[model samples]
Structures are given as structure tokens and as C-alpha cells.
Target: MNAPTMKTELMDAIKYDEPFRAHAIYYAIQQGYVQIDDPYNGLPADMDYDAIKKMQHANILQMCTVKIFTIPFGQGMHAIYLANCENDARAKHFTLYRQHAQRIQNASRRMDVSLYCEETGTHEVIRETKRRAAEFPWYVGVVGW
Candidate 1:
């Protein structure tokens, strides 16, 4: 019923009624009494880098945290949503906009945008709309806030 009892019974069975030399070979392999043929290939069998920079990228998905997204809805009103990521926040913002933006005053004015901004002085804000997943990222965020 337990490990020791099972091990004892197995050892007794192997010792008393084993067919030919199979018992000896099994025990030799189990107890490391025989030498095994092995060749070392130029590949990693475990995590290659133990450091932060070399850590696997997919492993960081578990490190994701709740992010606060403050997005403008309609008519000078701001909506806040606590989400896991930006996409989720965007989805919630869209749902709320559909429910409330139409009844608000001057809802269309919220869509107005100026390509030029005074914050950075000369540089304009560039917005990328396309979603890309195939290529490696060009930059990495080292700043932890």
C-alpha cells in the first residue's frame, strides 16, 4: 500500500521470478551500475541565461499588473478604468462611449485633434495605427515605474 512496501514487493518479485538477465539489466540501469552512451550536442537543455537581460520573453507575461487608463470620453468628461493592459482599457472605453457619448453636449468635439503639440516644443506626436506581431521589437523599456 505504501512506497516501501511496493518497493520491497517489486524487489522480491524481480529477485525471485525474473526471466533470464532482464532483472540484472534493469537493476543495473536503475542503480547506475552500468555505463550509458551519451553525446553532448551544442544545444541548451535548460535555461541558457540566468540573468535578467537573457531571460525568456514569454516568461514575463506572468509579471503583468493592473494599469490605470485615463481616457477622454465626450464633452470634457474623463473615464477611468483599471485594467490588465491597454487593449482591455480601450475596449471598456469604447463600450462606455457608446452608452454615454451620444447624450453628452458636443460629443463630436472630443474627436478633434491637433498634430502639433506644445509639450515637446518642436517635435510632433506620431501615431501608429497598424498592429505588428511578426518582427522583433526595436526598443526595450528599461524604466520601471
Candidate 2:
């Protein structure tokens, strides 16, 4: 939109995108198509050189994480059948009154979880190489939504 906003976005893009920054921005800087203040004096007053440099880290420590969702089932087969049954309100109420109360619960307890991924999803550490495995342990993970 505005010049300052676009500049900030461009700076963020160069910071987060390793390949693009390495090839394009670095090349442009080398060829004198673009210029950068080595001391980061051109940056906003709130940002320091070290802070910007920290944001430019291509490879940083990743954390291993696993999310286990526990879903509780509120009803059983009888409840499902009752819900699907085509009956009058009074008959359904009578049938429900005669049936016993039921509850279903499901959960995942303690389990081994090992695998780490970069916070930005740029690096997926699946192998136990020099980097410790800490994220995305599931071989084929999928996002439900």
C-alpha cells in the first residue's frame, strides 16, 4: 500500500525467504542495484542491527512438538439410533426415559514423541542427523482444517 509498509514487507520477505534473499537480494546488493546500511542506520529507530540480524537467521534451533487431541463422545449407539429414528416427540421421550444413561470418552495418554521442525515450517527435521529430532513425528501428518 504505502511506501513504508511496502518497504517493511520487502525487508521481512528478504529476512524470511532464504533462497530469494540469497539469489536475488544478495545479487542485487553485490551488483549495486540496491544498497544497505551496514550499521542498519537506515532502519527504523526501534530496530537495531543485531535485532534485524537475528531475524535473518536462516537456520535456528527447532523444537520438537506433538499435539494430541482428546475427543469425548457424548452419546452411544442407542443415542445415535434414537437420533436417527423417526418417532413422535412423546414416544421418543418415553423411550429415552426408559433407556439407561451412557457416556463415552476417548483420550491419548503419555507416548513417545520425537521430531522437530523449524518454527517457520521451512526446515523439517525428520532424520536424527546432527540436529535432534523434535517435531512432526507422524510420517504422514495432515491438518484437519
Candidate 3:
């Protein structure tokens, strides 16, 4: 969608508490803001303090939208799955990962976004890999498109 139209829709969606609008807000920030160099961190920075504040506000708005739309469903699914996997450690890990996945899904409201990162499997494979690597350290590999 065009920038103005997308911004208007995003503002309206934010008013109604729609999480998917975070994607639009993200796009708007990327489109309208300037990136600057950070002096201390030696990294790219945001020179416009006002724009940064606006972006942060948009992010908070998106988070609120996610809380409103997805928290209940996320809690329900977490409860159900955790109950089902009550005794199995691996299953518990999977369940926690599922919860994290739900949070990411809630944040982005996109199944594709949820699937994009290996980090989304935080409580399961990612945690397991770290846990097992204390002595017999090894890398867990992932291939993504």
C-alpha cells in the first residue's frame, strides 16, 4: 500500500488495537526516519530524537495491540499444551517454545514471521543446545530460506 494510506490505516488500527498494524508501523519508521552514526557505540544511530520517540510510541502501541488480540489465545494454548505435556521435559520445552512462538506470532501477527527465526524455538532446541554445550559444546545448525 501507499505510504499515506498505510499510515492512516495503521493509526486507525492502533486506535482499534490491532496487532498486525505493527508491521505497518515498522514500515513507516523505516520509510520516514533518518539513520545516523552513534559516537560511543560506533554503530548506526537515529539522529532525530523526535522520530525515535515516535517510533518507540508506535512500538508500544503495537505491543498493546498484541496484548489485546493474542494474549488470551496464547495463554489458553499454553495452558492446554503444558497440561498435555506435564511430565515430559522435552515436551515441556516444546510447550515453552510454542508459547514463545505465540508471542512472536502475536507481535507480528504473521505466521511467516513466526517461522522465520531459529530463535523462535527458544525454549526447545535453542535452549537445549545451550544446555548441552556446557561441557560437550557443539553447535546446532539451522538452514533457513
Candidate 4:
């Protein structure tokens, strides 16, 4: 198939597996694979630095990653035509479809996404400590992406 279609299929497959998706998302965020809007850039003059920083960090947990691959197959042959194998199903399909073909070429792109999860438990202790300091019902916000 075409690049866009292939990407969607691959990303959808990844999304079908929740654990993998979560890991990918966390990894992407830690690596800064996604970019968040600069809250301070267009903020009103009255807004202070702390508010801008909080806004920026609040959205930094969002993550996205794109993977692209090139496949060479015969004209009119698509990946769906290939049989799915137990081992490396997607790779098997690609290899079968792209056999000694020179003219027809295609590329696949996949984007993976992950949203923030407050109950991740990684920073609960620190969050609780900060909340205690505030002497109110609050949790420390996510600090590092």
C-alpha cells in the first residue's frame, strides 16, 4: 500500500497493544520526541513566569513518534495480499510482497501517541511530599517529561 495507508495500519496495530503503547509513549516523552507549545510565547503580560512554566510542564507529557520504512514490491501488489506468519508478521508480509521488484516502490509511515497518565505511580511519593508541603489537596505536577 501507499505510505500513508501503511503508516496508519502499523500505528493502529501498535495501538492495539496497550502496554507497548504506554512504554513507547513514556520513552518518547523522556526523550523529548514530541514538542509542546511554548506557553510563555504568547501569554498576556500579566501572566507570571511560574504560571507559564506550569502550563508548559503540564502539557510536556504528551508524546508522539513517527517511523518510516521503504518497501519495494511489484506493481499492483499490496501487503494485504501476503499471508501473515506467526514470526514477525508485518516483516514477513513486506518481504513476500517485495520480491525482486524494481519499478514499484512504496514507503510506510507510522505515528505512535501517548497521553499523560496521572496514576502511573512513578512519582507518587514525591508528589505526595509536595502536596503535604502545600497543606491542601494537591499532588506535585509532572516535572520531567
Candidate 5:
């Protein structure tokens, strides 16, 4: 399906308060973004910015778009399954590397490095990577076409 249709469907899901399913569609389409708490998934009730940021930093923010299941209750209650990708060797490597980099005690002395290593003078590469990362992340098996 096209992006516009997908986006509309996502918005509709959220507007209807179908929380988890909404996020699943969003992550399936928009990478690096997700709803804060999905009751169907058993997330903490007190989710806040700090919690969300923690998830983002750990790269665990995206929902599972490849597969999803939802059970709707007549009174707007629902159970949802947003199945995210399983961690593989590459993801583990990057996660560890990011953790090691973030451990520097000096506040201003940390060097910035991206997992995909587009750290230098190539604006085009950066832009392309950003596009792919957001529109079709490699982990989703949608990139490199």
C-alpha cells in the first residue's frame, strides 16, 4: 500500500484509540516513532518522556509492522500484539557499541558516531541513509531495493 493510505489508516487507528495497533502501523511506515504506552501490550501505566527516551536510546522504539494482531473489546478496550524484529548479531553489535560510546564521563568530550557510519562529509549519503532508515529500515527487509 502507498504511504498516504497507510498514514491515514494509522491516524484513524489512533483517533479511534486503538493504541497498540496504531503504533504498529506507524512503525511499519514511520521508523523511529511509536506511541508511549499500549495497554494491550502490558506497558507501564506511568510511561513518560524519560521512559520513552530510554526506549529510543536503546533503539527499541519501533513497533512490529511485519505482523500484528488485535482483539477489540466492545467498549473500546483492546489487546494488541505488535511483533518487533528479533535482535540479530548486527543489532547487538551496534547496541553494545552505542552503549560503550555513551559511557564517557566527560560531558563535552564524547565523539558522535552513527551506527551506519555516515559520519563524514557526504550530505547525500546522510540524506539517503536517513530516508531509508525512516521510510524503509533495513531491519524490516525493505531497504536496498
Candidate 6:
């Protein structure tokens, strides 16, 4: 499948897990993987920034480095693994994965905007956000490919 198709599949998988979708969307926005189209929507957008931030933090903790005190996954377990090993390997791997995940989150957020704004008369904001999201590889190359 092409990139856009892959992105949509990923996003659909994420949406199937509702909690994960919320966490991912918030994380994406916080990390600047996605930019808000217009901040001047007259009324505050539906997002609860504080709640989203908390969710993002929790999601990161769940997916990234395990607490040092925790036991490591045993051999033959299907734990997520990083391929390349370099100095600061764990940190680097988490960073890269987070970045990519955030992009997917951002795209999902844009999809939400597209779905909701029409009813709210925020078409301008929707249009702009869609345009920007489409520029991202996750959206343009992978989402609908």
C-alpha cells in the first residue's frame, strides 16, 4: 500500500482504540507534529488542553522507557524492539518513535477537525488545518494512499 493508505489504516487502528486515539491526538499537538489552523475560532475549540496534556504524558510513560526499577521483558517475548544500537540508544529510539507517532496523532486530529467543523461553521479553520495536515507525509503520502 502507498503512504496515504498506510496512514489511514494506522489512524483507523488508533481510533478503534478510543483511549489511545485521544492520547495520541493530544501528544501530536503538544509536540508540534500538528499545528492548529486558527486559534481565533471565536469560541474555544472543543479540546481541553490540560486534559489532553495529562493524557499525552500518561501515553508517553506507557509506551516509552520503562521505569528503571521495573523488570525487563523476558527473552522471546514480543516486546517492541529497536533495530539500531548506538550511544544513548534507548533515548534516541524513544525520541524517533515519539516523533513519528505524534505525526499520526496530528493527522487524526485534522481528521476530527474535518469531520466536526462543518457543523460548527468553522469551515475556514477546517480548510486550513486540512491543507497543512495534507502536507505531512502521514496524511498525504500514507493516509489515503
Instruction: Estimate TM-scores for all models.
Output: 0.25, 0.21, 0.21, 0.18, 0.21, 0.20
**Model 4 TM-score?**
0.18
Q: Compose the digit string of candidate 1's lDDT tens values, residues 1-145.
A: 4333323433443433322222333333344444223121221223223332222233232321333344554455445444545565556555655543222111112121222324444422111100111321111111111
lDDT of 3 at 71: 24
Q: Residue 85 lDDT in model 3? A: 20
Per TM-score, what order, best first? 1, 3, 2, 5, 6, 4
Q: List the residue pairs that clash in candidate 2.
A: 64-134, 115-134, 115-135, 116-134, 116-135
TM-score of candidate 3 against the unseen true structure: 0.21
Q: Candidate 6 regions off by >4 Å? A: 1-44, 64-145
lDDT tens digits by residue: candidate 5, 1-145: 4334555665665544444545455444444333423222323344354544554445453322322222232254322222223233234324433421211111111111122333453433222332344332132111111
List residue ranges in candidate 3 displaced over 4 A.
Answer: 1-4, 32-62, 65-145
Query: lDDT ranking from best to worst?
Result: 3, 6, 5, 1, 4, 2
* Model 5 bad stretches (over 4 Å): 1-4, 32-145
Q: In candidate 4, what are the lDDT values of residues 70-116, reduced to their tens digit? A: 23333533222111122232444435544442322212111121223
lDDT of each: 0.32, 0.31, 0.35, 0.31, 0.34, 0.34
Model 5 TM-score, 2 decimals: 0.21
Looking at model 4, residue 83 earns an lDDT score of 15
RMSD of each: 23.0, 18.2, 15.8, 21.4, 18.5, 19.1
lDDT of 5 at 78: 27
lDDT tens per residue, model 2, 1-145: 4343323434654444333333333333444544643322232333243533443453222111222222222332122111111232223333545533343111112122233344456534222221232322222122111
* Alpha carbon lDDT at 66, candidate 5: 25
Number of the predicted model whose TM-score against the real structure is largest: 1
